[model samples]
Target: MEQIQRSNWKFNMILLGMVLLLIVSIIYSITLGSADISMKDVYQILFAKITGNNALLEGFEKGWIDIVWLIRLPRILLAVFAGIALSLSGAVMQAIVNNPLADPYILGISSGASLGATLAILLGVGISFGPNYVGISAFIGALSVSFLVLLFGSSSSRADVSRLLLVGIALSSLCSAISSIIVFAANNRNGMMTLNFWLLGSLSAANWQIVKILAPIVIVISIFFCFQSRILNLMLVGDEAAVTLGQENHIYRIVYIILAAILIGFIVYACGIIGFVGLVVPHIARLLVGVNHKRMIPITILFGGLFLLWADILSRMIIKGVEIPIGVIVSIVGAPFFLYLVIQNSGERRQ
Candidate 1:
């Protein structure tokens, strides 16, 4: 009992710490960018906005309000919510497939989104959707590919881990080839540049409109996944074991994959394809807290949010006047961490 209490106490402490860190990170990130805004000014604008008290805005410059409220804060919040969505999807995928290698992109969702965005930019497909057509197309592509994956993987029997992964890889290759062909045949330099940027990912286009759409979806899905923690834990134990425990692993697997795909689709729609967070954050969470989804899910969400928030800050400040692609930054950081985890896991298996 004492040991259990100690564990619970430690978990709560870490959770609180993560929440505070995320808050601080957002405040600090708001102070970055080309415009020079002080922490005091940032807070004043935020307070005024929150309280609807123009009195709090008296001493602040108008530009600071616009920059903080219209520009920086939206991007930061998008990063936070995007991180949460991606990481939770990763955590759930890993458990469902019982493979640490499983991530949101592992199922070809990113490739599909890239294809959709490519078609939209290069050929003006889906232009009728207005200014955000590219994102809308990407979401449609992701959802379509997700359904195909589930359909094909489960055609023979229950969609086992190996079968599902194979289907995902095959479809991913097909999507990538199609995207390449479209880019090559279009011969539009501007379209190619746009496609490259979307493929690499960026939070530069973030605004309140995006945050409003993505934030609520991410929060609701995250809470829903939290309630499925017990089932997720069972999934990691293998299908036979789960069946013996009276859990219908296949039904749950299908549902989880669909839910994860929806989360990824929306995130891809909002921020393009920011990789590595989904793949690495969950493993990092597993290391910090054990494999219990109940404890691990919350921590994964917080860490993922903090990780991306800082990554966005670095992307903006890494080179003056030139913002690096956020996806590239994540891959640079995530690649090393992923390698280390693989090597460490391999060494442990050998031992």
Candidate 2:
């Protein structure tokens, strides 16, 4: 009991530290970008907005107010939520599939979303959904592919890891081929450029509307997963062991995959396909928390938020005037870390 208490205390401390770090990171990140704003003014504006005291805005310029409240805050909040959603989903995917390399995009969801967005941009498909129709189309496409993967991957025996991965790869290749055909056939160069940018990912489209839609979904789903931590832990032990423990791993796996697909669809719709946070952040969290979902989930969420927040900052500041795509930035960082993980895992196996 005393040891359990000590462990709980340590966990609480880590949680507290991460929350504080996130707050600081958000404040610091808001101060970056093309427009110059000091830390003091940033806090003042935030304080005024929170307290509903117009007096605090007395000396602050209107443009600064718009920049801080309208532009940067939404973008930062989106980054925070997106990071949480993607990382949480990634961790869940790895557990469900029993693969260390599994990520939210591993099921071809991102490629499907890209294809939907490509068609929407190049051929004006799904325009009836209004201005954000591309996002809606992408969501539909992602969800569709997720269901297809499950359907095709399942067999009379079971939906094993190898079968699921094979289905995902096959679907991914098909989607990529269709997307290439659309890109080549399109007459509008500008539309193709826009589609390309969206494919690479950007948080520049971040706005209050998106934050409103994304935050609750991420928070609620994350809380739900926390309740399923025991099952997730069981899944890591493989299907046979999970069955012996009176848990049906296949059913839970399907549920988790569908939920993960929903999360990925929303994320792709909101911010396109920002990768690596889902893949890398969970692994990093496991290193610190030892693969227990209860501990790893919250830590992964916090670390993912912090990671992408900084990545977004770098995306803006990397070039003199051009913003690098967040996807590109994440890939640049994630690929090397992935290689290191592969090497480490291989060494462990040899030992």
Candidate 3:
């Protein structure tokens, strides 16, 4: 009992530490950019906005107000929510499919979104949402593909993890091939280049509108996933074991898949396709808290946000004036970091 209590206490401390770190990281990220804003000014701007105090803003130039409030804060907040959505979804996906190598995109969400965005860009085909209709199209494509994948996977009484994975892979390849065809047939070099960049992912389009649309959904879904830790843990134990315990996993698996699909769809729409956060952040979270979903879910959420926060900072500042796509930054860093974690874990096992 004492040991159990000690473990609980330890996890609590770590979770609290992560929450503090994430808050600090978000604030720090907002202060970065070519504009040379200080932490003090950022805070003051935020305080003024939050409190509706015009007096607090009198000392700052109008340009500073626009830079801080209109640009940086929304971008940073978007990064936070985007990170949370991918990482939390990744953790849930790995558990649902019972594959350590699984990621949110492994289920064809990325390819579907890519196809949708490609069509919107190349053929001028999409639902009219705004200036950036590509993202909406991507959202539609991602959800459509996920629905098909689920239909195939659940054709049996229960969704077989292996079968579901195969189905996702197949559909993903089909989407990618179709997207490639569209790109090939379109002779517009500029549109193709734009499509290429969008696929690499970026937060350059971040704004108050996108953040407002994304934040509440990510928050609500994350909270829902946190409460499903019990079923998620049971997932890692395989179907027969869960059935023996009187829990039917098919319904749970289907529901989880649909919700995860919705979450990833929104994330892809918000930022083109920030890839690695979903694949590796959950593993890193597992290292910190072990495999218990109760603990892993929260850590994954914070770590995802923290990881992307730093990645976005690096993305913008890495080149003096030119900003690299955030997806490029994530892949470059995440590949090495994930490899290091794998090596270290393997070495420890050897001991």
Candidate 4:
């Protein structure tokens, strides 16, 4: 009992630290925009906006207020949701596939989304969905591929990770080929530029409307997966062993994959396919808290949120007035870190 109590206390402390880190990181994200807003002003603006109280910023200038409320706040909120969604889904995907290399986009979901958005931009196919048509198209692409992967991978008597991965690769290649044909045929520079930006990813167009669409989808999926930690742990131990322990690994595997796809689709719709937060944050969480899903899930979410918030800031401020693509920044940083992790893990496996 004493040992259990001690363990519980340590877990609680880590949770507390993570909460603080999130709060600090959120404030840091708000404070470090291009216009040089102070931390106190950010706090007052946020509090006043949330509470519907103008008294919080009675003396502030109108321009500063507009910058905080109209511009930066929505962008930051989008980043928060995108980060949480990506990181949590990554952790869940790692568990679903029982592979450290697994990410939410592993099964070509990102490629599918890219294809959809590219086609929509270059060909104007999803114009019926209004200004947000590209995002909707991307979501559809991701979900379609996700369902197909599950359908093909689960027709057998057993669940096969490699089979699902192969299906994803094939489908992704098809999507890529289709998208490439459209891009090549369309001789319009503006359309090609729009497609390229969608592929690179950014939060410049983020708004309160997009936040409204993203929040509920990501929150519901994240909460649902959090409770499935037990099943996820069973998955990590393999299907045969899970069946021996009275767990239906194949059923849970399909469910997890679908759930991951939904989350990934929503994220791609929200942020245009930001990578690495899913792949990188989970590994760091696993290092800190072992392979336990319950603890790692939330930690991964918080740290992922923090990581992307800073990444967004860097993307915006790294080159003065010009904004860098968030995807490019993440890839640049994440590739080196991923290589290091690969080397370290290889050494460990050798040992």
Candidate 5:
């Protein structure tokens, strides 16, 4: 009874922390943008909008209102959902593969999506899909490559994690070659420019319409994965042990991969191919709370959301009045941090 009560208390505390972070992040995201809006006006506008109480509203600037309410808010929400989806997928991937380095983009999903988007832009394929045809094409490509990787990776008598990694790398290289060919062949200025920006990733395109589409996909997936901590724990124990315990890791492996692929595809489509969130967030979560999935999953998602929120903010404000690609920001920071973690871990192991 004591243990159960303790667990409940811990869970409640974590939930409270998450709620506080969300509220604080929303406020910060709303108040700080390219166009400055005072916190007072920000709260008044939000309060009046929510409660229909215009008593506090008096001659506020419309431009700031539009920037905060219409533009920056949606982008921040998208970043939150994207962060959650990527980190959840990353944590689950690490469990499924039983590898510390496993991430959502490890299995060629980003490359495939990038190839699809490149094709759509350079070759004008899938133009009939509407305004966001590139995103649609990219998602289809990601899902397709993911399915192929599973099929090839599972072709052996035993589902080996090494086989999956090798197959994923090969497929990723193939997609990259194809994308390069298209870019070179097209030789069009606008197509190349569009492809470059898309590859680097951005949340500048966020809107309510995008939120409506991506929210359910990401939120539902993240919630479902949280309940899967038990299965994930078993997966970390190796396949032989899992079989002895009468738990089929292969089936769970495929399911996790498919779900991760879908979430990753949507992210790639929505924000281009932002890298390292999956790799970095899960490692940080593991370091903080050990390898236990119950604690790791939620913490990873929350940390990932916060990390990307700040990354997005910096991407916008790093060079006054100029937006930097988020991918570049993540790569710059993640590379050094990853190196430091490797050295520190190696030293500790030697010690």
Candidate 6:
């Protein structure tokens, strides 16, 4: 809350601490999974593999190298970026609509993306697109549906908060219903099982190929968003107020929506619908850093990465042997937190 008045040195120190903490957490997290691997061994394996020095890999078990280099690291990295992407998107979107409750779920983007992926998995919707076509299918569906939402909300070229939200809800219902119809009609038990597990979300399938693709896009978009602090702040004031400040909220809202759409598309493509990370993280960040995007975005991004990284770790060990789906873990935590946010927001409105 004191971010605006906090000294740059203090803020910078905190930021550096969070960065270092995320690094330390990543190292620690990699060592704790089913396989018995030490932090020292984790470091040696990373150094050897990353440096392409086979000689350094001499004494270690081949299975340990496979686990560290191929399995755990990419999964952890996916969780980090997915967390960052959702949190950043949620922050910007809450600003765009000037609504604290706005997120991928509320805006229907997740359902739309889910519908796309369902089609890809069941019906081979984007098979022609080659490798990772499912992700491509999801990207197309999210972008297309969000554009329609914007178009409907922006009747006569002006998008309003209420219109956007209402249309989003309607599309969410429609998309979910359509996806259900497809699943039932397909009547493929194995595919149904696949879809159910996928909808629940897991990082089990994470690989270096996905990490190589998703990490760069997320980082690039995150950097772009930091530079947009000014525009994001303007968005909170509503179009009428923003007009007086000589900013056209319509165009900016459209641009922000498209960016958010693209961001959510790729996220759903990577991790499935890990719901409530978006809804919960930004509000927590706002409480810590206040409403200033400049003050809040970096903290939001880091906090998000940390939250999901730990959540993934919890998902692994929560059960005696079998891992819990990461999405279920988040929903168990997030649903009640959302109720709290609603109550808090209402209490403020009453005052």
lDDT of each: 0.84, 0.84, 0.82, 0.79, 0.80, 0.84
Flag the better candidate by TM-score, 3 or 6. 6
Residue-level lDDT tens digits of model 3 in 1-351: 999999899899999999999988887777788987788988898899989998999889999999999899888998889899889888888887786656766677777877887888788886467776866787778778877776786655555666777888899889878877787788778767766665788888788998988888899899998899899999999888999998888788778867777777777767877776888889988888899999999999998989898888988887899999999998897678667756875788699
Ranking by lDDT, best first? 6, 2, 1, 3, 5, 4
Q: What lDDT would candidate 5 get against the real structure? A: 0.80
Summarize candidate 1's per-residue lDDT along 61-168 as a digit string, tens digits: 778788999998899999999899889988988887787876767678777877887888788889999987877788778878877877886645655666777888
Best candidate according to TM-score:
6
**lDDT tens readout by residue for model 2, 1-351:** 998898889888888999999999998888887887888888899889979998999988999998999899999999899888889888998897777776756678777877787778788899999987877788778778877877887777555667877888789789878987788777667866766675688898888988988888889888899899999999999878988989888778778877787677778878888877788999988887778899999999899899898889899888968899999999999888877877886888799
RMSD values for the candidates in order, in angstroms, are 2.4, 2.3, 3.2, 2.7, 3.0, 2.2
lDDT of 6 at 143: 75
Off by over 4 Å in 1: 55-62, 124-136, 150-163, 344-351
lDDT of 5 by residue, 159-275 (tens): 566677788789988997888778878887776676676678889888888888889988788888889888999999988898899998878877887788778777887788887
Indicate the TM-score of model 4.
0.88
lDDT of 6: 0.84
The Cα RMSD of model 6 versus the native structure comes to: 2.2
lDDT of 3 at 297: 94
Stretch of 10 with least lDDT, candidate 1: 153-162
- Better model by lDDT: candidate 3 vs candidate 5: 3
Model 4, span 113-197: residue lDDT tens: 7777777777787899998797778877877777776677654665467787677778877876777678778977876666666
